[model samples]
Target: MKTKLWFLLGTLALLLTGCQSKNNSGSAQQLNLMQTSDLLSLDTSQHADLPTWNTLENSMEGLYRADKHNQPQAAMATKVVQPTNQGKTYTFSLRKNAKWSNGEPVVAQDFVTAWRRSVSSKAQSGYNYIFSGIQNADAISKGQKAPRKLGVKALDKHTLQVQLEHPMPYFNKMMVMPAFFPQNRTALKKFKSHYGTQSKYLYYNGPFKVTKWTGDNDSWVLMRNKYYYDKKQIHLNKIKYLVVKDANTAHELFSQNKLDDATITGVTAKELQGSKNLIHEKKAGNYYLRVNVRNNQPLANAKMRQAINLAIDRQALTKNILADGSLPASTYTAKDLSIDPTTKKDFAQETTPQQTYNVKQARTLWDEGRQEANLPKKLTLKVLGDDQTITKNVAEFLQDELQHNLPGVKVQIRNVPDKTASSETRSGQFNLSQTLWLADFADPISFMGILNSDNPQNYGKYHDDQFDQLYQKAILDSSNNQQAYWQTLRQMQARLNESMPVIPLYQMVESHLVNPKLQGVLRHPVGEDDYTRAYLK
Candidate 1:
C-alpha cells in the first residue's frame, strides 16, 4: 500500500526540563546551544527538517503543544479538545489571552487563513499533504476543490471548528505540528513571496520570538516573548543557537564550556560515556538506506536491493562506529513505540522481524540482480548522505561493508551539505540515499506512512499496491476496531521485510551534553525538549 509523506528528523533537541544532571558546572540564565545545520525555512508549510520544526515549535503556538511526556497539551487552545461526528469533527476554544509577539490577538481566523493558504493551488506548500486528513484538504490540494471548501471554519473570534473527512486517530497529536500552527493572513499577504524568507517576515506567538535571523544567517537568537499567554512559565530570557556543521567543533565548544548543550556522536560519544552531565535516552527514529530503484539502476533489481540490505552489519555500526545509545534497527519503525492491540506486547518484540545478514546469500542475490538487470559482472553505485561527521563515517563504513561482502561491487560515497543532500534525494539525483524518519506522531502508522508507493517522501519510489491497500485498511480500521488495525500493521511490516526497498540500520539512542546546572529539561524520545520550563540551577 502507498504510504504518506515522511519527514526526516536529524537530531532531537536536548531540553533541560526533567533531566537528572549533577551540578558541577556553573549556572547561567541563558542556555548556549549548538545545532548542526542552518535553519532552512521557518515557513511551516514549506520547511520539513527537524531543526526548522524545533524552531517553529518554539516561536509559533499551535492549537495544541507537546508536554513533557510528548503528549499533546493545550498551548493556544484552552485544552485538548475532543472530536465530534464520530471522531471526525473538533471544536477548539482558543485562549483569548493569547497574542502575537507583535501585539496582535491570536484568533481562530489566523488558523483558518494558514490552513487555507497551505492547501491552496498556488501555495507550493511541501507539507500540504499533511492536511489530507482534514475534509476537502485533499481536494483543495489537488485543485479539484476551492480552498473555501476546506473543513476548518471560524465560528467566531475565539472559537474554531474543524471537520475531517474521516476519523484521524492522530489528529490531536498532529495539532502540535508546525503545519497546524496559525498564521496571520495580514503578515502572509504583506510579505508575499518573502514570507518566512526572513525572520522579520513572520510573527511569533509562542514562548519566544525570533530576533537576529537574516534568513541566511548561521546563528540566531530566541528572546522571551512578553506577550505570550504563558510567559510566566518561560524561564530563559534568551536562547541562542549557532550552526556548527562539525561535531568536533560542537564538542570543542562544549569542552570550553561555551555551549550549555551539544549532541555528540562517533568517537566523541565513546569518550563522554558515564559523565554526570550526560542524560541520554533512546531516540525515537530509525536510520535507513533508501535505494532508488528507478532509471534501470542496478538497485532496481529486488535481488540487488535485498543483497545490499543483507550485507550491512548493523550491530557493529551501532555499537562500534556510532558508539551511542543507538541499537540495531531490524525494521524501519522503532520498537517499543507501537504495541500490538491484541497481545498488548511491544510490536518489534512480538511479530516484526529483520532480514538475515549473510554475505554468501548477499553475493548470490547480487549475482541474480546483475543477471536480472542484464548487466556485466561488475557494477558501481554511489551512496548519498550529508557532510556531518557521523554521516560521513557511516557512509564510508557502509561503502567498505558492501564492497567487502558483495563482490564485483564498487561503492562511492557522495557527501553534501545537509540541505543539499535532502534536495538531491527528493529531486531523484542519487542512487542510494541515506535517510531517517522520526515518527511525526507517536504511532506505527506514522513510520509506516513513509513506505507508500506514491508518497512524496518515498524518494526511492518503492511502490507496492497490496501494501498500500493494507495500510489504508489499517488507517480505516483503526477508528472502529483496534485489533484489526494492529493485525494489518503487522502484515504491512511483513511485506516491507520482503520488499527491502529501505534497509533499516539503527534506532539511535539519543546522546547529548547538558549543563550540570541546568535542571528540569524533560527528555522525550520525540520532540524531546521544552526550554520554556527550563531553568538554570
Candidate 2:
C-alpha cells in the first residue's frame, strides 16, 4: 500500500508539470477584427480598392507613413536622401533590425525583387504603370527590355536606389504602399502562385502576419508577429475579421461586442446616432454614374448625360436614402479636396452645384439628345450596380426620376454581385453604372492623374491630350509653383465635366462604431487605415 501511494503521487506530479508547460506555451495575444469584405488577395500590386489596400497596409508596413496632417514620415526606410541636381534620383537606407516573420533579414534586394516582379510583363500587375517613371519599367512591361534593367536597384544589402523619369512631390506617399513593399524571393519561389494565401508561404515583416484564411470564407484572422521589428508596440495579439455584408448583421455583431468596429448603413445610422463610439469620417471618394461612351446610341450624347444629372433630386436622395452626412456632389473631387494651397479657394467653384431638380430642363435635353441620335419613341437604358442597399436605392431613384421626367424613356435596373459589378464596369458592359474612386494618396494628382488616357484605372476610357499634358506637367513642376498646379488641376476638372463620361453623384460620409478599448487607430483623409500604432487600452 505504501509503494502504491508513492507511485500515484509521482504520476500526479508529472501530469501537473506537463499541464503547466502547455499553459505557459499558449499565446496571450489576440486582436478582434471588424470587416465586411473578405480579402481576395494579399498581392498589393493587383488590388484597386482602398479597403483592400488598407487591409494590406495594416498587415504589411511600407517604407513611409503619412501623418494625419498628410506629411510622410519614415516607416521601413530609416532615411530618404535626394540629390539636388538629379531630376528624380532618390536613395533609401533601411532599418537594420527589420526581419521577416520567417526570421530572414529584410534587405534592399527584397524591395528590388518585388518591384522587378511587379514591372515584369509576365506578372501583368495592375499597378505596373505606377512604376512608369522608373527607367526601363515601361519598356520592360511592354516587353521591349528585360526587367533586370529597371531603375530600382540595391547598391548593398541595406541601401536601395530609385531613379524616376520625372520629379514627383508625392513620391514619398507612394512608397508607403504595397507596390513598394518588399517580398521574400525564396518564399515567392517556393509558393509560386499560392504565395500570399497562407501564413507559412507569406513572410511578413510588418506589424501583423496573417495566421489563417479559408479562401473567400466569412472568418479570417491576423496575428501579431513576434519577430516584427516593433512588435513591442503592437497591442493586439490577433485581429479577427469577418465578412458580414448585411449592415444589420454587422450592427448586431457590434452591439453584442463581438466586433470591435463596424460601419452603420441604411436605417441603422438613425438608431445609432449620438452613440459614444460613433465616428463619421469624410472620404475622398465620390459615388458617380458612369456613362459608357463606347455605346454609340443614346448615351454617347453629352446632353443625355446632363439630362440624367439634372433629373435626379440629390437632396432628397441624401435625406431619404443616405440619411447621413453625405454631401451632394457637383464634381468628381470632394469639397474638402478643392482647397487650393496657394489661392486658398475652392478649385471646383467653376462647376456650380445644381441644387434644384429641374425636370423641365431634363425633358428638353432628353428630347434634343434623342432627336440627335435619330431614336423615335422610348429609349431603353440599362443601369448596372451591386445589390447593396445604397446602390439599389440609387438605381431605383434614378429609374424613377428618369422615367418620370422623360415621357419616352425607360430605365432597367440590373443588380449583380459586387465582384461581378466591378468586372462589368471595367469591361464597359452596361450603358450606365455606379462606381467610386478613392484617392490612393494625399495628392490632387492621385485623384486627377488617374483620368489619364493610358491609366488602367480609367474605366470609361475618357481621353483628352491637353488634360494629360497638364497633369504630367503638374507632377514634374517644382513644388514652388503652387498656384500653377491648382489652376492646371481645375482645368482638368472642367474638361472632365465637359466630356461627361461620368456624372458626379455625392461625396461619401463613412461612419464607424469602434470599441472604446482600442487606442491609437490611425485614419487618413485618403481613406487608409494604418493600425501599426493601434493597441488595446
Q: TM-score for each prediction? A: 0.92, 0.88
| Structure candidate 2, residue pairs in collision | 30-238, 31-238, 33-240
Summing lDDT over every window of 10 consecutive residues in candidate 1, give the lowest-scoring window. 4-13
The list of candidate 1 runs beyond 4 A from truth reads 1-28, 120-125
Specify the highest-lDDT model's number. 1
lDDT of 1 by residue, 13-51 (tens): 223322323221212367787667768778876667777
| Worst ten in a row by lDDT for model 2 | 21-30
- How many Å off is the CA of 519 in candidate 1? 1.8
Model 2 vs. true fold: TM: 0.88
Off by over 4 Å in 2: 1-29, 80-83, 120-125, 138-145, 197-201, 295-297, 349-357, 478-480
